[model samples]
Target: MSTFQERYAASVMNTFGPPKLVLVKGEGAHVWDVDGNEYVDLLGGIAVNALGHGHPALVEAVSAQLQTLGHVSNFFTTPQQVELAEKLLELIGADAGGGKVFFTNSGTEANEAAFKLTRRTGRTHVVVAEQSFHGRTMGALALTSKEAYRAPFEPLPGDVTFVPFGDVDALAAAVTDRTAAILLEPIQGEAGVNVLPDGFLATARAIADEHGALLWLDEVQSGMGRTGEWFAHLPSGVTPDVVTVAKGLGGGFPIGACIALGPAGELLQPGNHGTTFGGNPVACAAALAVIRTIEEQDLLEHVSVLGQKLRDGLVADPRVTEVRGEGLLIGLDLAEERSAEVAAAALKSGFIINNATPQRIRLAPPLVLTDDDAKAFLAAWPAILDEAF
Candidate 1:
């Protein structure tokens, strides 16, 4: 093994099996291994690096915040913290002073906070969908429908029902008046970017209204301009009562938020939940910088244009059976179950992609990924497939 691999195996836990690469540095949508070899980073740190590596705005914001105030405990609050919260509500179009926010350190924490908030509705049961990945935390994992992940962590706060994703009837049948909330991902990121059917979110909203349940949409992986929209559910014209956002929210700084709208905002009392490093000034500054940079650089429009080009170009190859997802969050099915081989081949040839499943390849490149880099990948696509096949 390489020196870095040996050290990593000795020090880091094996939760994710083995490290794929000993990456030492990155800039834009590219990364360099410890051996000085470079690769185009199509995964974009699993959709977290909105501005990519070594972004000046992100670096400057973090540095400035640290220089001003390094940290703040939960008992205290900072201007950056409040500003970031307001900014998130504004971005989601919920800033009419009706939205409330709970900050967390990651997407899983955000979901966990939302989970506890649901319980305060005086209801115990929650309805989720099959093949949905909320997070790995205890509370979030309880809501996840994957047997493999759930089996290992048995009895994860029960009362969560799993329904067929994209099936409005099944969801409606499962939810009752006692149901605390109905949680869903706009696109199933871990299930290889499975796209929810058209109007599925809208149907979910109607069902939640009928059942007197909170409509909680987990936008952890699909939000923060990942879909070329502020939130994936916004286009459907459904205003969710609860929304969990993370991943790209901090542009790699590790920050998340659970936003509650309407009456759902008051579900959590003062002592309902708390965190030490959730909304620290540094983290908030990082998130604010990410948001501001996205607007100023027009990264949303760029992502929209580049994503279409990529999806269209990828599907043009016969080896790719289908492509799913919007904007930066993309997945494609191979003609056969060789996604691992394809991903390995791509990596060997200086590209980093994800083998999300046996037959699915996922790509969530940085929003700031340049047109030249995308075109380069497109030109190299046919050869990558050929080598893998």
Candidate 2:
């Protein structure tokens, strides 16, 4: 019989290369492959599984909502949808007013919605940061700065200028009267969790305001308490006109939202955007449960404590050269460009992690990751590095 790997290669697109392992089931931060080998899930489905696997709250909310009202088209709205939006606004400290939400089924779509909203500013040009990642969709792709991802897809919705990330001077030079928005990721996740320099976001906000451009932060991978805060930009105290979020919003249930604040919230009129499955009751219910669970369990505070422990542990090893990030969204540089080998070694030792770049390893475990799991990984860190080297 053909193995799952063989079948996967034959039927699926080669975008992500071969599958790492045939995962069959999961509970909390642990997952079992088809061979029944258990592993700690440190990557958390690339930061999408905020609640980890089969959290009771998430499962119950999705199941109950499905049974009650599975979906409703854009022509109508559901209480779950409205309630989830309100909850997000409140969580982000946008409750003061002038905040509105547009839901999507994925991060890319959330960006697409925000992209269109920016266009309504009567300016077509957008300033994006180099080494940034927005999404794969055409519009989001246009704002993304990686040449490899954008080169082949060129002629993408044009008028975007790429500036050096975390460089306030470069950003100031880029925005002009024709610029509609200045897009940035609170932390560039796909580019190995790169954090901005001190005061960079606040500078971007100021520059955007000076040029009448919207400050659009793509928090798709850094939002939803990943940085031990509701949003990574919150600590900077800079309020972005547009914030796009996903990855952790539904705790693995697949949901995204584009929130526009103040006058920017009014840019997208009724006919400007719509989605068929964006804010369906089931997805909204899932998101609501994830948010409520985080609050009720005080996971953010737990994440802050555990993250410091894990970061300190990882950096304690000589094999790790540099550690950067906040809370559970962490990135580390290895002594050598052997991140893939390290990831493989980690998997062999019953762990799951991600190599976002040749020399960078990113850890975005579920907020529910236990102390024991983290300690285990730390205890095995030396061995894992030795094996990889």
Candidate 3:
């Protein structure tokens, strides 16, 4: 009989390519392959496992909520759904009564909701930064700057312009009277964790304000304390009109949210947008548990300290050309274009990492990552580089 990997290759679409290792179980920051070989999961499922795998709190919350109320149509609401929305608003520092939330099952859907919200401004034009990734859906695809991802699905909803990321002048030049919103990622995660230049986000906010456009930030990868803060843009001190978040929000169970502040919150009326399972009770409960776990455990502070250690350790090797990022969202430049080889070497060395580009290695480990696991990866770094190069 064919193995699971062989079956996967035959049945699954070629979207993500072949599987690396067939993982069977996980706990905290570590996972076990089907053969029982252990591996430290530094990628944390691309930053979605904030509390890591099999956390008791998350498991218990999901179980309890599922038993009580698995799901309900949008025509009705659950207490968990309303509570999660209020909690999210509080965490985002927008609990001032004017902020509103539209929940979805994934980040792309969250962006879709925000996309429709932008259209309600009576302006079709939008200014997006180059190398920005909003989502894969058509509406979000139109705002995305990558040609490869957008080319296959052309005739995308138009009226969107791409400007150079981190260029204040380009952003200022891009927005016009017809611009509905200025959408950006606090740090471009898919483009290899490209952090914005200092004052870049503040400049975008000013430009949007000057043009009477909404400032929308895609925090799908950088929010929920990933950067040792509630949102990556917090350091910029600019409150955006719209913020799209997901990834780690539910800690594994899928959930996404698009938050709009002030008058922007009122743009989406009853008929504008709707989803059948956007705010299901179980998903909301899981999200609440994730958020509460972060607060109770003070994982944000841990991420800040541990991330700095990891970044410094990775860049100490001469083969590492440079390192950039904040908190746990780290990206490094290798001296050679051998990131895929490096990833393979890491896996063989009993760790999991990601190669976002030919020479860029991205690391977004769980916020609850242990010091010992981090130290072990650091110890393996030089050997991994030596083997890859």
- Tell me each candidate's TM-score: 0.99, 0.98, 0.98
Model 1 whole-model lDDT (C-alpha atoms)? 0.93
Predicted candidate 3 versus true structure: per-residue lDDT over 1-389, tens digit per residue? 23988999999998988889898999999999888899999999998999999999999999998888898889999998999889888877885696999999999999999999999999999899898888999999999999999999999999999988888888888899999999999898888889999998888888898899999999999999999998999988998999999999999999999999889999999889999989899999999999999999999999999999999999999988999999999999988899999999999999999999999999999999999999999998888988898
Off by over 4 Å in 1: none
By lDDT, the best candidate is 1
Q: Quantify all predictions' global Cα lDDT against the true fold.
A: 0.93, 0.92, 0.92
**lDDT per residue (tens digit) for residues 1-389 in model 1:** 79888888999998887788888899999999989999999999999999999999999999998999978798899999999888888888885888999999999999999999999989999999999999998999999998999898897899999999999889999999999999999998999999999999889999998999999999999999999998988889889999999999999998999999988889899888999899899999999999999999998889889999999999999999999999999999999999999999999889999999999999999999999999999999999999999
- Which residue pairs come into collision in candidate 1? none
- Candidate 1 weakest ten by summed lDDT: 89-98
Per-candidate clashes come to 0, 0, 0
After superposition, the stretches of candidate 2 with alpha carbons farther than 4 Å from their true spots are: none
Report each candidate's C-alpha RMSD, comma-separated, in the order given.
0.8, 1.1, 1.1
Model 2: clashing residue pairs?
Answer: none
